[model samples]
Target chain A: MRAFLIFTVFLAAASAEHCYKEIEKACDPTSNKADSTPINCNAKYGAIDGVQSALQKYVNDHIERSFEYLLMSTHYANYEKSREGFEKLFRGFSDSKWNTAIDLIKYITKRGGQMRFPEIDSEISSNEDYEMYELQSLAKSLDIEKTLAVEAHNIHGLAARRRNEFHDPEISSFIEEKFVHKQADDIRALSGHVADLTKLLDGRDSSLSLYLFDEYLQKL
Target chain B: MKSVVLATVFLTCVVFASAQLQCAQKKPNIPTDWIDMASPCVKKMRGQIQEELKASMQYLAMGAYFSRDTVNRPGFAKMFFQSASEERDHAIKLISYLLMRGELTRDISHMIKKNLVVPKTEWATGVEALKDALNLEATVTKKIRDVIKTCEDPKDSSNFNDYHLVDYLTGDFLEEQYHGQKEIASKISNLDKLMDKHGALGEFLFDKKISGGE
Candidate 1:
């Protein structure tokens, strides 16, 4: 019976040690105090700082592009023979870009990261000819969106790779399922739209093409 | 000995509970990108801020016009100056709103620095200046309405129908804008009638009244 008691005490001590070890592993030293209960900071996940900075820049770029579209709309509105269709189209594009930026900001904040605001250049030069100016603007926007899509893909890839390094299957799957795959599909669709716009601009009359573009954007 | 075992179990439970509580204190996993910074309503608000600043600048110009020795209407000048300050305050409020919502306001600052040209430097008459002021106020009212409309659902499906923004704008701004526009219109009508009935003497007296002189 004495021997049985000694074994029982050893087992209890071992169980307590195991429990304490598990708790210590989860508790973040920076936030957890020795005197108080350990605080878990599992929210700090892979390559967060870098990913956050990139996302912030991406948000800024989207806002800047939105502003550019706004300028384009204003230009079309003010032109001698105002192209209402073009103005409407540009306005739609501006709204779309702005929404995307907001979506990005929302995503970043959801991840427990602070947002950084970027300065935008609002000066846009207007050409004498509305058609040429608008075509150029559309093309410029296409290039910007393409670049943005690539940047987003890269960030997603980085997050995935970091999750792998940390052996964090949950985060890896989350990034893949939530951001990376969806962004890829979105970029592909946007690229197709850009191609369609380019083709339309090349073959059609400026007025009809602009009107069609406005209709197409409205549908989007 | 049985009591000691119960005590150990109780201590274990206590430690676990404390740890769980500490973990629970972690901030809610709010995705930072939840607030759409680029919503149409938000963009309109951003534009409105610039418009407010422009209106303020125009008011300052009107003030300067009235304050001139030849145009000596201290009352009109003082009124314009006050209007200008009020418009500036409106712009600041918009800026604060943008910041609170985590939207960027730096672009407006840049736009103001690079693109803001001076308003009409000289007015032909006090009536003309007041007319412009009325027009400015009207434009601002329309823009505020547009902002409120954008905040409403069905216009932009993506918009969150942010009631707080609607409340802030309609509650504080629209009322003031309406009141200001009405006040300017009244002043213009009164000035016009005084000019018609009393001629140059009426105009002189009106100027004196505006200037706070007997």
Candidate 2:
């Protein structure tokens, strides 16, 4: 009887730990005095720094696996698994979180626009016809660079637009022509490096939902 | 005849015990719609935190871009950097919280793509900004706490183990509020001391120091 009772207690403990591994990870050791893991820091809290990583991780791992299976699927079982994963990921958000994420996604896509470039060195000595041909040649050489430059430019424009919309700054000619313009150029310059790389890459294409979900889910 | 009576009594007790167990172990029933609705609030809070982090980073950058030690007072740049880092941590924590809740988050780039600027003409501006930050933190704390309490209210408390989450979030809000108030108070007091020692020179010193970070 004594041995059986001890075994039962040990099993209960093991189960509890299995169930609350994420909560244990986030809990501050010094403050969470009641238990090595606090009961409160479970999936219910849904806050990120607290225990959200664990849940997200759990969701992410299974989703990825489902994706992998779905990618290779020839059977009904695989489809069901993928469907289940998709639904769970979709349903994971509370109404507020879903709306916010959708809004952000919409904002990003909406902000995607053509970014214009400033005129380069107009003073180069050449005949008008020669200059036109030379300009075309220069443009051809800068095809890849220009694409990246455009993206960088657009991203900056988007960021500036966001900033402008936030505070109703007086769109004075001086301010608009000088400060905001300069700021936009600076943004383009800052993102110039990454934009260049993005243009070159053509690797695996993951959906936005999958990417975001996977990033957070792996932690759960 | 005696065995039958005993068996009947045993069956009665078993039924009573099963009923008691059912009452004690009632499964939680969280409202699905509520979860969906509340998700946006969490996302908005996250967006706000991202905005704060961007502001803090801009402040640090401004200090770095413009100031020199001889021109400005000591420690202003360090303070801005510190504040910026803390806000970044706060943003990360917010993301972690959402991830834990199984809510998905896209890149902050989508929500906050622009470089935020904090206009700083002088040293006291940094201090004033810190005070404003503390007030914002306090506001966030209240809002998060209220969210938790609302979740706990019996009227809508059907979600299984959501109460547990509320409890955890409450702890986080308290800790953040403490940090915000403490840092703001410290910066304000430090600024006051600098003012007493150098007057206008002290003020300019702080401006260059913070605006042109060390």
Candidate 3:
């Protein structure tokens, strides 16, 4: 009876954590996609030595960026009547970043990697001198988006290269699925903003334009 | 929108490259901190944000409980989810108000609170959950009142009574809290009476009403 109970528990766990490779169903239409998603909570699934830690670093970075977005929002708070709009944009961005970090942490845990509660870095990334102007702020934000996109692209590349070793592909695919496309959308959106802001400001500081531009940002 | 097109054309600037914005330069920094509220107010305000967050999480849990297949009360789930969203908005409003007071250094630095625990996950009936929500709003109201009490009193040794913060919470947060509490209590009373008469069928009908029978 004791052996049967233990066997049942083992069976349940085995069904729970079926590895991504193990979930390959023959004659499925998605064969070409081969999207590296785990079908079960793979108990034995583990990553290459450095891949999980690298993913951990990005998770921490996203968490840090979330606060940075908040700090940026705070800086924009004292601007004018437009503070409401800037406040809306940065706070929303902050929430979205935190949500992304949360997703990454779950993925890490799912892949059998330990999530490190690393002591948060206190440094904020907003440049008070540069970001004061709406145009400048958008440009700086565009730069941030560009940096994050590049980093996501690079990590996705890393995961893809390491896929030959088995567990690395799943890590790569997780990054690709979660981070890559979002970064692309963010970059596109921010680039549009930078262009629009540049056109609106045209090397001049106009209070009315700033307020109007901020209102537009609030919607996003 | 027509006026916007012409404005965009005229506003287009022939300035330094976008790359300059990425780097450091001496363009005058305009800070928003017109007045920094006292330290004590900052602490209390931060605590209130956490309280709001806790209430949001509890509502979220209640929503999930009602959403479960076994308990499947869509009306209750919808109401709780809406309440959760409302609570989150309240937290954001408090945070924004705190920032508006130019006390960003203390509050923004300690931004998110960790490990928010929702005390209740399951309920015996719809009345039980409604009662829990009523209790929650009352607790939140009391917390807001306590913050107001400390901020308003001159003898607290802080030597600074933040009239603006006190007025803001009382006029805004307290008003919302009272309305919310009254609505929840009324619902509980109605649900109790209905459940007592027709049992689960009454609950089913009440749930429809709560979910906006329209």
- Judging by DockQ, tell me the better candidate of 1 and 2: 1
Better of 1 and 2 by lDDT: 1
Which lDDT values do the candidates have, in the order given? 0.62, 0.40, 0.68
Candidate 1 — which residues are off by over 4 angstroms? A1-220, B1-38, B105-115, B154-157
Candidate that would win on lDDT = 3
Compose the digit string of candidate 2's lDDT tens values, residues A160-181. Answer: 3434232212222223443345
Write candidate 2's Cα lDDT for B12-68 as tens digits: 987765444111112224443433325434555556555554544444443332232
* TM of chain B vs. native, candidate 2: 0.54
Candidate 2 chain B: worst 10 consecutive residues by lDDT? B19-28
Q: Predict model 3's lDDT versus the native.
A: 0.68
Query: Candidate 3 lDDT, tens digit per residue, A1-220?
Result: 9999999999878755565335554335666545644444333343445576676677666656665676567666742323667767777777787667656645554554555544432334332332344555666677777878788877777667734444467667777787788888888888887777666554334555666777877776
Candidate numbers, best lDDT first, in rank order: 3, 1, 2
Per-candidate TM equals: 0.41, 0.35, 0.55
| Candidate 3: Cα lDDT at B184 | 83
Leading candidate by TM-score: 3
> Which window of ten consecutive residues has the lowest lDDT sum in model 3 chain A?
A121-130
| lDDT, candidate 3, B77-157, per-residue tens | 778877876887787788678756655533354455443445667789999899889888988999999889878764445
Fnat value of model 2: 0.00
